[model samples]
Target chain A: MNQIAQEVQHQTHTRLSEVSTEDLIVDIHGLKKYYGDVKAVDGIDLQIPRGTIFGFLGPNGAGKTTTISALITLAKPTAGSGTVVGFDLHDRNNIKKHIGAVFQEQTLDEELTGLQNLKFHAEMYFLPKPVAEQRIEDLTKMVGIHDRLSDKVMNYSGGMRRRLEIARGLMTDPEILFLDEPTIGLDPQSRANILQKIKEMNEEKGLTIFITTHDMEEAESLCDQVCIIDQGKIIVQGTVDELKNSLGNDFVIINFNSPDEMNLAMNLLNDLPEVNEVKSSGSVLHIGTKSGSTAVVKILNTLKEKVEVNSVEIKKPTLNDVFLYYTGKELRDDVADLSDRLKMVGRKKGRRGMMRRR
Target chain B: MYASTSKSQDSYNGFGIFTFIRSIWTVYKRQNARLINSKSQLISIMIMPLLWLVIIGQSFNNLLGSSNPLFSGNVNYITYMTPGIFVMITMFSSLFGIISLFYDRDSGYLKNYLLAPISNTAIIFGYAMGIYTRVFIQVLLILVIAIAIGANIPITVGSLTAIILFPVVVSFFLSGLAITLASRASNVETFQAIIMPISMPLMFLSPILYPIKALPDYLQWIAQINPLSMGVEGLRFVLLGKIYTDGAIIDIAQFNDHLAIFNFALLFLVGIVFLIMGSKTFLNSLYK
Candidate 1:
C-alpha cells in the first residue's frame, strides 16, 4: 500500500511536468483585458508551438486586434501574464527584440524611400549600419520590392506599400512575427503575393508566425494550427485536419430510388449498434459511423430485402463543416459585402489623406 | 542552404559617448534633410520668421515705446524686443514639434520606436533632441535676420552660447510636454484643440512682448508664477545682460536691491523644475 501511494504520487508529478513543458512558444494563461465596460479579451488561454503558423480567426470587434496588440506589447494586458520568446510581455523592451509585428495599419514613412524606411527600422533595432544595409537589400529582394528600393514610398502602389511594411518588420531579424490582417483589403494578386512571401519566410527562415484573419480559407491554407475565437473566447483549436477529424468518422451518404427506400434504410441502419447517426433527406440517406466499410456492407445486405439503392458515396468532413459544428454558424455568413468591407478596411488604414494632413 | 555563422563579432573600438552623440547627429541630419528636401516649405519657414521680425517689429516699435525706465536707460525698442522675439520664435518652433509627435502617432511610426529594443527613455530623448535641433536652427536663422534688419543684437560669445543652450533646455521641456499631450490624444483634432488654448494663454501670460513689471500687481503675480515667463526672463537676462526685477520699478536709491537675486534664482529653478516635470509626464504617458 505504501509503494502504490508513492508510485501514484511520482506518476502525477511526472504527468504535471510533461503538461507544463509543452512545446509552446507563446503561452497565454487566463488573459483578461477590459476596456471600461467591455471585456475585450475575456479569460482566454492560448499555446502556440515554435516554428508553427498559428491563425487567430474571428470577426470584427471580436477582440482579435486587442489580443494581438497585447501580445506584441502595443497594448498592456489587464490581468494574466504571458511570455513571448521567454520574455514577459510586461518587459516590453526585452520582448520587442524577439518579436516583430506588422500592424493592421501601415506605419511606413511615406517621405522616405523604401530603402530608407528599412534602414530607419534597422537602426531602431540597434543593427550596425553595414548589417542593416545588407539586411535591407536581402529583405527588399525577398519581398520583391528590390526594384523600387530607391523610389519614394508615396509613389508606390498600395500593394507595394504593404510589401514594404512586411519587409520592414523583418529588419530586426526576430524569432517570431505577428501579422494582423495582413491581406485584409488587397487585391487577389497582391494578397497571393504577400501570403506566398509569408510562407517562404516561415519555411526558409524557420520563423514562427502568428496570423490573425477572418477569412477561413486563408487560415486553412496557411496555418499549421487554427484557433477559432468568438465573443472573446476560443471555441475550439486544432490543426485543420485534426479539427475536421474530431467531428466524426466517414459519412456514407446513400441516395435511394424512393423516399420509402430511404425510410426503410434508416429504419434498418438505426437498429445496428455500429451506426452512430442515420438521418434521411428526402430520398437520400446519410449514415454516420465509426466504420464506413462495415456499415456500407450491412446497409447494402439489409437493403437487398427492402428497396433498391441507386447510388452511394462517402464524404469526409471539411474545415467548413468543423467550423459550422463548433460555432453553429457558417464562416461566410457575416462576411460584409465586398465593397463595404474594403471601405471599412481602408478607413482603418488611414493612408489616403495622410499626405494632405501633413 | 547557408549554415549558421555563430562566431561572435569583435566589439568595435569607438568612443561610446561619441557614438551616442553621433546617433543624435545622424537623426538631426535626417531631420534637416527632411526639412530642406521640401523646397517650398523650407523657404516659407525661413522667410516667415524674417518677415515677422521686419514687419511686426516695425509695427510694434512705436506701440512698445520706452516709457518704462528699464528700456529708456539702455536701448531702443527694437533692441529690447529682439531677445524677447527670439525667445518667442523659439517657443513657437518648439510648439510645431508637436506636429512631429502627431504625425508619428498617426502613422504608427511611433510604434516602430516603441517596439524597438532600445530603452523608452532613449526614444523620448532622441525625439526631444531632434526637435531641439530644429528649433535651434530656426533660432539661428532668426538671429541672422534680426542682425541684418538693424536690430541691435548682442554678438558676445557668452550671449551666443546662452542662446544655443536656451533652445536645448526649452526644446527638451516642450518635447516632454508634447509627448504627454500626444500620448493621451487619439486624433489630431483633439490634440490641436487642447494645445491651442494652452499655447495662447502661455504666450499672453509670459513676459514676451512687454516687461513683466509693466503689468498690474495681480497680473504680475500671475506672470511671476508662469513658467514661460521665467524662461523669457532668463533668456533676456542671459542675452541682453539685463538685470531682472521682481515687479518693482527701478529707482536710483534702490539700484543696489533693484536686481532681485531671488527672481533670477527663481527663474533658473523653475526652468529645471519644468524640465523634470515634463520628463516625468513623458514617461507616464508612454504606457497610455
Candidate 2:
C-alpha cells in the first residue's frame, strides 16, 4: 500500500472494526498470485464492506483480473490468502455457491437461447423448478430483455447479451456480484442504461458489487470506493474523493488542435512556477498543480502566446489523474490502449477482453 | 428485481448428488439444444457411414468374389462390413464430444460451467452423455441402413437386443476418449490434429476391415489392443451370428462360444477408465 492508501486504510479500519468482521464481504491480506517467474498479484491487503460497489481501477497487466480470479476461486493464489463472502479462498465450492460473476471474457453459450442459458445456470445452482423459472422471468424483466428470452444469445446485441449475462449471474441470488468490465463494448446509450440498472440494483436490492474497469469516468460515477492497482500491487485504495483529495493536485485540461502546438504549450506551462505536472493525451494537455483555478489564467495566457488553445477547463483531480500519477504515464497508456482494443475484442469475439496477467 | 441485491432467506448450504445429476442433465440438455439448431450437420454426419458401407462393401465384394472366407455361413461382405462401419460411425460421431469441448473452452462458455456449484465429475459425465446421445442417434441411422440393405442379419429378439448395446458400448468408450483428448487439447484445430493421427491409425490397424487373424503379425498385435476392433468383433458376433476369422466363423451363441459378453465387459472397463481419466484431466484444466 502507498502512503495515501495506508492513511485511508488506517482511517477506515476503526469504523470497519466497529461494524463487525462479518460485514466485511471481502477480506484479503497479503494475497499473491504468481505465474512461473511472473508475479501477477503481489502481496496486497484490502477489505470491502458489504453492499457497496467497489471498483478495481488499474492499468493493463496490473493484476486486477488476477486478483478478481483469486477472490472468485477461478485461480489459486500462490501465496497468502483471503475470504470471499465468509468463505476461505481455498474453499472454492463454498465461495462459488455464494457469488455471481460476469467475467470480462464471455461465459455464455451463444447457440443457446437466453432462457436456456439462465435455465442451465439455475439448474447448476440447484434453484427449484418454480423458483428458477420465476427468477429467470424476474431477471429478464428487470434487465428488460424479457421479450427476447427465446432468441439465441448469438442473435442478441452486445447490450442485450451483457444484460442476460448479468441476469444469469444473479440466478443464484449471490451475496456478491462480480462484474468484470460490464460495459466494455456497448454504445454510450447502452452503457448508460446498464449503469442505471446497476445503480437501481444497488439501491433497491442492496447488492455488493465488485467491478474492475479501465474507464475512469464510469468508475467515478458508479463506484462507492475504488482501488487503483499497478504492477500487481495496490497503489491507492479509498473512496473517489479520498483518492482525488490525497493527490491534492488539480488539473487544467487545455485542448489544442496540433501536437506541435500542444508540445509548445507543454514546454511553456512546465516552466511556470505554479504548474506541478504537464502530460499530453492526444490533443489534450493536462497540467497539474496545487490549485488549478489559480494556475488556469497563467496557463491559458502562456499557451495563447505560442499556440491557439481550443478550450480551457480547470477541474478537480480525477480518477484518471490518480491513475496517471500512480501507475506511470507508460503503464496508463498501455491501459488506455488496452481499453480501446478490448472494446473491439468484446464486440468481435468472446475470446478474452482482460489481458491475462503477465 | 435483482435477487442478489435483496437478501433472500433461501441460501446455499451445499449441493449433493441429486444437484450434481441435475447439473449434468442441464449440460446434456443445453448440448441437445445447440445440436437442434444445426439440422444439416446431422445429415453430413450420417453420410460418412453410408458412403463407407455402400462403397467399400460393394467394391470389396466384387473384387474378392462371393467365395471369400468372410462370406462363409450366410455372412457376406455387407454383413461383415456392417459392424466395421458401425464402429467407424461410433468413433466419428463421438468426436463431437471433443469438438464441443474445444468450442466451449475457446468461446469461453466453459467458464460458466466451472463457476457453477457442480462437481467436475458431473461436468464430464454431462458432456459424455451429450455427445453420446448424438452418437446414438447416428448409430440408429446406421442401424436403419444395415436393416435396409438386407444383409442377412439375425432377426431374433435376443440378437436384436444384443446388437443395440454394441454401438452404445462403442460410443461410450470412444466419447470418453474424445473428452480425455479434448481436455488436453488447447484449441479445435489442435484437437483435430491430435485426433486424426490416433483415431485414423487405430481404425485402419484394427480388425474393422478384416478378420483379426487375417492381419499381419505386427498389425495383429495392434488389433489385439485396439478398442475399435473390440467393438467391431463384438457387434459382428451379435448381429451377424458369426465371427469372421482367418480360417472359419465361430457360431455366435451362448452355448457354442459367445465372445460378445467378454467384449462387452472389456468395453465397459475401457469406458470407465477413460471417463475417470478424462474427468480428472478436465477438472485440472477447469481453473487453469
Candidate 3:
C-alpha cells in the first residue's frame, strides 16, 4: 500500500512539473474548423510556450485567421478540442479574460477618442476604474501614444491608430496578446516602431505574444518560435535554427557555364555522403551540406570528375531560405489543386445549408 | 507572466450579477456620450417628433373640424392625435437604432463586447436600454409640448405613472423587433432593406393618425392587434379625458379600466417576450 501511494505521488509530481516546465500558453490538438466542405483549418496541433513571442507565418488562405477565430471562440471547431491560457476554448468567457487580440480588421470606435476607446474596453472586460486608468496610462506610454489619447481615432494616423489598438488590447492585462498582421500596411519606420513596442511588451510584462505575419523578416526578427502554414495545413514549425537546420546548416551555390554541366555536377555532388539536398535553377546549382568547409573540397572534386566549376559562393541560412526550401513549386501546385476541389465541394454543401435554412 | 498589472483585476474577476449590470450601464453611458457629442444630430432627431406633431396633427385637425366628433373630451382632435404622435416618434427612433447595430457589427465594435468576459445578456440589454433611453428623451419632449399646448391632459399619480411607462413599452418592443431583424443582417444596406418595408405596416395599420372606431371594422381588428396601437390607446387612457371618436364614447379611461388594462398587459408581455427572444438569438449568432 505504501509503495502504491509513493508511485501515485511520484506520478502526480511528474505531471505537475511537466506542465510547469513546458508552460504552454496554448495547446491545440487536431483542431479542425470547416466552412461547409472547405477545411479552413485541417487537423492543426500547436503548443505555444508561455512568455514567448510566437509567429504564425502563412500565405493568404493558409488558415491562420481561421485557427485564430477558433482559439478566440469566434468560430467553433468542426472537430477536436483545445485550451488557451489554461482554460478550455469552450470556457470562452474565462478564456477571454486571459487573452487579448488585435485583429486584421480594425475594430476601434472611430467616433470616440483613443482614451474613450480604451475606457470602453476596460468596462467591457469589467476592469475597475483605478486599475483601468493606471493600466491605460502604462500601455499608452508603452506604445508611445500618450499625447494622442484624447484625440479621436478618425483623426489619428494609421500608425497611431494601430498603437492605440495595441494599448486597448492590453487594458485588461491579458496573459497573452494575439496580433493578426500588426504591421501589415505600415511604413518601414512605423513597422519598426510597432515591432519595438512588441519586444518591449514581451520584456516588460513578460507577455506571451502570438502574432501572424506574411513578412519573413518580421518573423525572423521577432519570433522565438514559428509555424509556417499553407492551404489549411502547417508545413513546418520550430525555432529559426531548427527550421534552417532542417535543410542543412550551410549551403553552397555553384554556378556552371552550361546547363548540362550543372546537371552532371549536381548528380556527382549527391553521391557525396556529406551533401544533404541539391537543386538546380538554369546554370546555377544549389547544394545543402552539414559541413560547408569540408563539403566544398569534396563537391569540387566530385564536379571535377564531370565538368569544371565556374564559380562557387557560400551562403548562411535564413528564414527566406527555410521558406523556399520547405515550400517549393510542387507543394504550391498541390495546394492549389486541393483548394479548387474543396471549394467546389464546399459550394454544393453550402447550397444545401441555404436550402435547409430557407 | 508576472502579476504586473493584476492587482486591479482582483476586484472585478468574480463576474457577479452587479458587475454585469455595471457593464450594461457603462455601455449605455458610452452610447449616451456618443449621442450627446453629436449636437446637430440630436437637434435634428428632436425636431422630427415635434414637426410630425405640429404639421400632421394640425392638418388632420383641420380636416376633422370641431364638430367632426373624433374625441368625446372638450380637448381638440389634435389632442387625441398627440398620444399617437408620441408613439410614432418613439417607434421611428427605435427602428432606426438597429441600423447602428448593423454598423457596429460590420465596423468591428460589436466584437469588443463579443470577446469580453461579460455575458451576452449584458450586450443585448446594454444596446436595448441605450436606444430606449434615446427614444425616452424624444418621447418626453413631445409629451411636454403636448401638455404645454393646453392639451393639459388630466392626470392623477397612477395615470401619470402609466403615461410615463406607455412610450417606454412601445420603444422596448420596437427595439426588440430591431434586434431580432438585425441578428441576420450582414450590412447596413441589408438591414435597412429588411426594416424599411416592415415599418410602413406598423405605422399605418395602427391607430396613429386615426382612431380605431374611425376606421372600418376589418382595419379596426388590425388596430386592436397592433402593438403600437395598444401603446397609443394606453397613453390616451392615462393622459386624456374621455376617449372618443365620431361622438362614440369609448370605455378606454382609467375609470372604466378592464380593456385598457388588458391591452396594456398584452403590450408589456409582447415587449418582454420579444426582448428575451432577441437576446437569445443575438447571443447564439453573434460570432457565427
Leading candidate by DockQ:
3
lDDT of 2 at B153: 66
- Whose TM-score is greatest here? 2
lDDT of 2 by residue, B182-214 (tens): 677765667778777778777887767766666
- How is the predicted docking of candidate 3 categorized under the CAPRI scheme? medium
lDDT of 2 at A347: 45
Per-residue C-alpha lDDT of model 1 across residues A306-337, encoded as one tens digit per residue: 78889988777767676677767765536464
Ranking by DockQ: 3, 2, 1
**What does candidate 3's lDDT look like per residue over B1-288, in tens digits?**
327557656655656888888878877877877787666658877887778777887777778746675453565776777778878887888887756666677667787878887777667777777787777777778777777765546658876677668777787788788878776776565777888887898888887777667777777777667778778876776566453432354423233467667877877788777777887786677665
The alpha-carbon RMSD over the true interface for every model, in angstroms, is 3.7, 3.1, 2.0
The digit string of per-residue lDDT tens for model 3 on A12-89 reads 345434665248889888989888889899998777888889999877677999888888888878887768998886
**TM-scores of chain A, one for each prediction:** 0.79, 0.80, 0.78
* Collision count for each candidate, in order: 0, 1, 0
**Candidate-wise lDDT, in order:** 0.70, 0.77, 0.76
Off by over 4 Å in 1: A1-23, A249-317, A331-358, B1-41, B65-74, B181-183, B213-217, B242-288
Local lDDT at B48 for model 1: 67
Model 3's C-alpha root-mean-square deviation from the true structure amounts to 7.3
Q: Model 1, range B119-178, lDDT digits (tens) per residue?
A: 444455565666666677678887888777666667899879867876666666655565
| Candidate 2 error regions (>4 Å) | A251-312, A330-358, B1-15, B65-69, B242-247, B250-258
lDDT of model 3, residue B150: 51
